[model samples]
Target: MLRKSLGALCAVLMCFSGLASAAEVPSEIKIGTLYASSGNYAGVSMAQYSGLKIWVDQKNAEGGVFVKPFNRKIPVQLVAYDDQSNTATAATLYNQLITQDKVDILAADFGSVLTSVAVPIARDHHMLLIDQTGSGATFFSKDNPYIVLTSLPMSSVWPKHVTAFLTREGPKLGIKRVALLYATNDFNGTQAAALRDAIKATNGAVELVYDNGVPTNTTSYTVTINTIAATDPDAVVALGYVNNDIAFLRNLQDSGTRFKWLFTIYPGLETEAVEKNVGAKGLEHVFTYLPSSVMAYKPEFGLSLSEFRAAWDARFPDGKVEFGFNSVAGYTTGLVLEKALAATDSLDQLALRKAIVGLSGKLKTIDGTFELDEATGAQIGETQPLGQIELDEHGHLRFVTVYPPELATGKPVYPAP
Candidate 1:
């Protein structure tokens, strides 16, 4: 009789413990992020912010996302701020997200320049930064596991295809002399260094005639174009952001000084923005990184490219934010969070990091295969392939994947006529 009484007591205690665990689950998951409303990074920043919103809204509509620890769905609450494109402002806001709002998830802004400020802050606070598009090489180190790059590969890895084409295919196309021009920022600076090292490793197979770095804010490039023209380089590689590319291309067009081959970053990444500022004729025959916004990658998780694009249009009919690579990046960040939450054992920051790391090579999204360097949390998959822009018969712009034969959609048109 005493034994039976003890068993009943134990059952009651277990039931209460289970109830306590369930009660500990928070009512909502707070996701904190920042966006630039007005500045050089404004266009891409807003696009990314809109993409994240799409995910949050979609999940809430379906009765919230599943949390494994609680074994139940919990609604997401987004806590966001505008940094106005200032790094100092971003630093303060990042701290506020952790200490003040106490967000469960902390995400950075659009690109490297903005994301740079959040890296150390997140680390100092022991929060995992969901880096959306900042791909600077310096940002990732073995010592810091407090960050993860979700959308783009590291900046140093970005020029892999570009270097291959320059060293191997470039010689075949009669491209000997090359000129390198880039914005002096973390994003373009690292790429310039990588490209320089790759070209130099060729041992005179290719030569850099005029290599220069200009301030990121410099809009006028007529003098720079003239300088590069004097070098008579067969190819001119201009690495910069949307504004820099637009100004450089416009200057090149106005000066009527054309290199045999020209390459720029934004023509494909921010297609609509670049195309709108620089006409079809300006971007024609330009080489760029073929963005996932145009190239469809079969995803194992989340919405497909076409489906996400349709949803973006429906939500943003006014077209204030352009749908491009950054837009896809923002949504990709949300997908990572969703998967992490579903697999995490608890809400502890380190637990969330472990859950995300476990998803490294397995999670394939619209952005491409989501793989990470386990030590540094830097993205290693979803590489950017080389592509060239060509105007169709209708004068509409189209991308032709040229390099990396396995994924090549069409041959490259060397020596722009």
Candidate 2:
């Protein structure tokens, strides 16, 4: 009779322990982030924000996301604030999210400029920053474990295919002289610097005849175009945000001065916005980084490209925000977070980072192969292949992957008429 009593007591104690562990699980995961509703980053920021919201909504409808630490699915509450595209505002809000809101996860806004301020802040707070598209090379370093770029490759790596095209194929196409123009911000500036260094390393295989950095807000490019025209560059590479590209393309078209080859970032990244601003004629024959928005990378997780686009259109029927690469980037961020939460042993910041690191080479999503440089937490996979835009017979725009022979969909129309 005493032995039976002892067994009952032991069973009761185990049940209580299990109850205590179950009680420790929070009702919801708080994901705090910033978004720009106004200013230069607004368009891209909102699109990315929308994509993330779609993920959150989809997961909530399916009874929330599975979180391994709790051993149960927990609904996510996205605690977001509008930074208005100001770094100062973003810094203050980032601090609020960490110190005041005490969110479980911290995510950055769009692009490098807004994300730059969050890097040091996240590090200071010992929080893991889920960087969506801030691909600035300087943002990643071996010592910083508090940040992970989920969407885009680091800016330095972005120019690999670009440099290869210029050096290997450019000379054959009579593209020896190149002109480089970029905004003086982290994202564009790093890319410009990388391209310049790569060209210089070629030892005269290809050279930059004109290279200059304009302010990110520089809207007028008439004088700049004339200056570049005087250089008689065989190719002109303009690296800037959406606004800069739109303005430059517009000015170039107005000036009736055309280079044999022209490359810009946003025509492919933010196709709808750029085409709406610059028109299809201006975008035709333009070279750009063929983003995952246009590529059909087989995803091992989450929605495929076409399915995601359909979901995007369904969610954003009014179309206030343009659908583009940044939109895909935002959704990709959520997918990474979901997978990390499912694999992490605990909600501790470093533990979360470890979970994300473990997923580096294994996670494949709509954004292509999700891999990272473990040392720096920089995204190394999901490369940006070179492509050229061409208008279809029905007057619609389409991408033609032209460089890196293996992925080439069609030959580039050199000396574009």
Candidate 3:
């Protein structure tokens, strides 16, 4: 009887210990994604969120990221917060995610203005902050140790491509005069400086005839439009987000101002906005600078462009997969974070930061193979292609590669004459 009782006690103890161990398994790893889904940047932000969800869904299907140290996998749960396109709201969301939600890691918001606030807040809390969308060179300053810039800064590709295009074709087109416009925001300010630098580099006699930076909430663009029209420049380069770009274009249409070339910035090159707002007729024969993703390049990434496009469209059918660079950007960011965790085996901020900084050495991302630049600590990628836009028979914007004969999908159309 005594032997039997001892054996029963041992068995019970083993059962209890096993239960305890199972309970210790982490249920989930929390991550926070901040984006403006309701306000100004809603179009692009919504697309970004959709792309992120696809990655999250797939990862969860695979039982989430494997935490090597624990020898277990933990599902990733995103605590998404909408900033409503306000910087203050974004800052508050960052605080709440870090202090209350206690997410394992934090992602910088979709725009530079939003990231400007979130970056400092993450730095204050000593958390790892990966920049997913915001790409002003100013954000890549050496001061912010907690912040990591994963995308190619607007400065990196914007100026160089513009300069190269102009150097080869400026005199041919008689595009000597230039007008510049930018949004009164951090990202645009950084880009304006880069644009000026590009103009100087070309030494092609381009004049900054009309330079204006309008407030974010500027509703009426009549004055700005008239001023740009008065300049009568050969080329007009206006740098703004989607809304600002649309408004400026509408005002330009109202004012009946047409230029040889209009280099609108960033998301304007997106097919959705071009179709809905600019219209096929409105955007016809316009040249814009978009990221390399739209122009096509094969750099030996583990994944192909077609795979990325198919995955994106399958997830968000209503969303525009045309210029899915930002979506790819967000997805690439999530993958990089996963790889970093796998390599470091820890979610500790410092360990993750080190892993991120060391990413350039070993990782191959979908955007292209890139490593961190020692000078700016930003991931530098390949050059972007210059693409022109035209309307199809259905009034949809068709992006055609027009520069660098090697990647030319079609010939360049200048002056639209």
Candidate 4:
């Protein structure tokens, strides 16, 4: 009889302990994000994804984010998915994150294309969006209080700095003719429109000699280069993806057609793959707008661009740095999210978003100043830094800041010398 009583008591204690553990699991901070880990976009998305993962690792190590409402610190659980670089795949994964995984916070993927898909979903779910690198202007045109951009400005203004540089500096070299080739997608289309408007900055000093919109699927730029060469513009600009940029440069090189200035949207400021594929001589004197480079340093944010690169190098020795504007966006997204979480100290979606709106000019990052137009959800404070691709004294190619006099690393080299 005594033995039977003892077994019953032991069983009751085990049931109570199991219930206690379940209660603790519900209080954790859950962060959900998706990225292209194994496709055309993987080269870029993996770098950005690493930034967020690293942040989560650091926070959890420090006992996760402190929550005032819970009256105790809670660890973070990062739930991520591989989108395979397909729009359809990303959309499906987003639904899973919302319905199946039921994550508390939703973060965006690598670039504008992928992020565009998540904007609507975040609004429908009334979830706060910690936007990564999706800077399209369309997302901000509507009412979406649950979103905050931490990297780059609206897509329409991405080329503002580079355009201003050409407008203010082009006249000195008698540059009067320009050519523009862009992809048909929203990102490139917006940039093309901005370039057209940027012409007014020159006050008729520079005119568009060639403007063309090519389909995104084009595999070769042989005919495109021949078409542009016929215009004989003083300078050439292209708004395209990595592959497009590579094709454009290759045809221009093989055809022996040269221009005074050649600037492109990607493969320069957005990714390091261009340097490897185009070779040093092919990329010399090219120009692009860098949202943030591992080359530049900003101390106010307590983030080190060089150190981040070194850490990435050490952790993933075989992985490509892919270090560029988007990589900075990835890391900065974590910083922005961390601040907002602490400011609210609650998982309530509305409270989290309110904290982000309240955090404007007050936040300075390695990427530059971060301020949002609360109404439009547009990023207004950050400005683009124009970078020139040049060979250093040691003959290694580097993106050196040239425009905006304030951020100039070296004198500008024109005509692709």
TM-score of 2: 0.97
**lDDT for each residue of candidate 2 in 209-233, tens digit (9 for 90 to 100):** 9999999999999999999999999
Candidate 2 CA-lDDT value: 0.94
Winning candidate number (lDDT): 2
Tens-digit lDDT track of model 4 for 169-261: 887877778999998776788888888988966678988999999986565888888899899888888888776787788777788878788
Error of 1 at 269 (Å): 0.6
Stretches of model 4 off by over 4 angstroms after superposition: 1-26, 200-203
Q: Candidate 1, residue 149: CA error in Å?
A: 0.5
Total colliding residue pairs, candidate 2: 0
Which candidate model has the greater lDDT, 2 or 3?
A: 2
Model 4 RMSD to the real structure?
A: 5.5
**Decreasing TM-score order of the candidates:** 2, 1, 4, 3
Judging by lDDT, tell me the better candidate of 1 and 3.
1
Query: RMSD of model 1, in Å?
Result: 1.6
Model 4 clash pairs are: none
Cand. 4 Cα-lDDT: 0.78
| Order by lDDT, highest first | 2, 1, 4, 3
Residue 219, model 3: Cα distance from true site in angstroms: 4.0
